[model samples]
Target: IHVNISAEIIKCPQFVRALTIAIVIVCSKPNHSYEDFFDHVHVKLLTCYIRSEPLPEPEIQAREVQCLYGIQIMSAALEHPGGMVLRLFHKLYQDSVISKESFELWKKEDEFKAGFDEDLETKTMAVVVLISFFLSLA
Candidate 1:
């Protein structure tokens, strides 16, 4: 899960590409779930940033943590069903784990991309579960 990215590219574009490649390599490792991979990357990236520069403003750190939790919850919800997921999503939105606008956009996009009638209850449950998971992490 701990990915080491090193490159000679100094240009921003090339650096981004290299970073992406590093992430891909880490994520593609066997026997690791996406959530675990993400956690590892987040911890490493945050640690590096903290060590190399001024610490993030408290608000920024809080927001980043929220975002990470939101992602984790979303992944969890995708694997289960119930009203809990929906409630969790709503809570995250309210708590600013995800911006409301972004959540709406994601919801719309997901609906469109579903390609069929997905169960409303299930979708709601997934969101709730994801939100709950995020809060728990926080």
Candidate 2:
């Protein structure tokens, strides 16, 4: 989990590589159940720092790939304890991390503003996925 958080929050390429390698390793272990692995491995998180300069194409592709991986694992992570799933969803939405149908629901809810503002991170791994793709081709 710390690794996931660090990869998302910290804009370092090294951390992204480490997190990607870690994710691939976790997914490769057939013995581990999705939920159990998620709980233990902590497959969660993202935060986008608005930047003036664009990232290199390779790095952008890498980020997009990471986000894709996060999207694949997100649903299962939500099934676990704590509000990780919802938190991730909100983070993703707030940061425009991913395009989700339910974002309309968030906009309709009165509590969304307060909740979104208070939370520092949005789990919009999907948004990252989308952003990465755009950046890669830029």
Candidate 3:
């Protein structure tokens, strides 16, 4: 979830710090259940973003923020139980944050393969690893 903070945003140190704090809180591994942590983080993020002054294009900024949130959710899914993860994925898929077709391909890589293949596994694992690393940092 690499966010490209525009130059306009970068100039505002307070906003940047607030946004950074929000991101950190949202991505952090909580001492409590992930569900509770996620709920708290979600509410905090929405409140912070909503009350802030509008960006040049609020819709686009909102979409970028939503996409980042989706990635954070996906990271949580990977670290938790598979059932929990799949449920999150399903919800995001329905919301169109995650493409259903891409997920289906991820689900069917082995079955769809014409022959023995390492590439699919490698790619999938890489994504998992990268997300996990970021989540850890958060």
Candidate 4:
């Protein structure tokens, strides 16, 4: 019988590189919808990625990579053609997962605001990536 590996992968330690890869792979599958990214399972994962304590050298690196990968997944979801990028953006925005301060900066700062107002793809990625990096640092 086939099994859903994503659920199992979610249970893996946050420092496991495979966890990020598995999550992205599974969520990108045709059978899965963008909604899966906001599910409780992933919400918890995001919280862990943001709030978990730093680990030792190699593991810390792995954790950072995973956190970055998680952000990359969200960015990819937003950039995918024929996808609900706006819906995903709204979900992350409303849920406060995208960093309120950064989102505000995107709205407030002229340089950042212009890129965001123009709906530039790279700007979306940049904001989320930076916020995720900050989260990892915290």
Candidate 5:
């Protein structure tokens, strides 16, 4: 689980994306249970994201990790729906792995407009997850 990137370098945008991609890689592993995935996410997320200083403006870093993670992790998340996926989403925000600004930007942007515009199901699922995560906040 030594993701190779240093704490200082983890502040970089590319490294953040790479970290997220690592999460996706673990998620896509075949035959894994949600519990197993949960363990992996907890470890990697805490190690790579929480321990490092969050990327902030004026710091010059990529900020799309949340949106990218939402889209890429959709399939794996959909498997557990309100259980694992929703909890992961909550942890992402609560732990500040996803910033409030990122969620706001995610809300404003048509994330699926590029190629997933025609995918009503995917769009719907993304919305559901977003709403669910928000509602849990209230």
Candidate 6:
């Protein structure tokens, strides 16, 4: 929807790729509840981030785990802008669909704290902006 199917947003290629993965997972399951969608999307991303040859670490790529949670929030926000972002986040929290740990993890991430560091090339500044507006209901 941002452009052609293979297109990546120029400013944040890594984040855009991550966003695309989130969007695809959502589009593939329109009727899935947030819980079900979360479980399903998480597995899909693990496949992309993990390798069979050798295990990277025991953390299960915690950064991606939190960002996976973040993109779902971001996607819903984009789909329905305005205060809907906060509202959806609250509902997700109340329902226990998203955990408090994920919120904290996202906030601590370097991309969230360090501003738009082109050096990292992740450039997930949008998530940082969203976090600043966050209410921290947890």
- Which candidate leads the pack in lDDT? 5
Distance (Å) between predicted and true CA of 64, model 1?
A: 2.1
lDDT of 6 by residue, 48-72 (tens): 4332224343333443344444454
- Compute the lDDT of residue 33 as modeled in candidate 5: 51
Instruction: Report the candidate with higher TM-score, 1 versus 6.
Output: 6
Model 6 steric clash pairs? none
Error of 5 at 43 (Å): 5.8
| Ranking, TM-score, top scorer first | 5, 4, 6, 3, 1, 2
- Model 1 per-residue lDDT at 69: 35
lDDT of 1 by residue, 32-93 (tens): 44433434444455334323334335433433333333333433434542342344344444
Q: What count of clashes does model 2 give?
A: 11
Q: Which of 2 and 4 is the better model by lDDT?
A: 4
**Clash-forming residue pairs, model 5:** none
TM-score of each model, paired residue for residue: 0.29, 0.26, 0.30, 0.41, 0.52, 0.35
- Tell me the spans in candidate 4 whose CA falls farther than 4 Å from its real position: 1-22, 53-79, 104-138
lDDT of 2 by residue, 1-138 (tens): 544465455564334334434544455443444333323223343223212138765554445434433433433344332333344444444455434433332222332121123221233433333453334323
lDDT values of the candidates? 0.40, 0.38, 0.41, 0.46, 0.50, 0.43
Model 2, position 39, has a per-residue lDDT of 35
Order candidates by lDDT, high to low: 5, 4, 6, 3, 1, 2
On lDDT, the stronger of 4 and 5 is: 5
Which of the numbered candidates is closest to the native, going by highest TM-score? Answer: 5
| Alpha carbon deviation, residue 130, candidate 4 (Å) | 16
Whole-model alpha-carbon lDDT for candidate 1: 0.40
Tens-digit lDDT track for model 5 on 1-138?
346656556554545445555565557555655444535455556445433554345332233543344434555444534445555555566555565665555555554432333344554565576786666555
What is the clash count of model 4? Answer: 0
- Model 4 residue 62 CA deviation in Å: 16
Residue 119 in model 3: shift from native, Å? 12
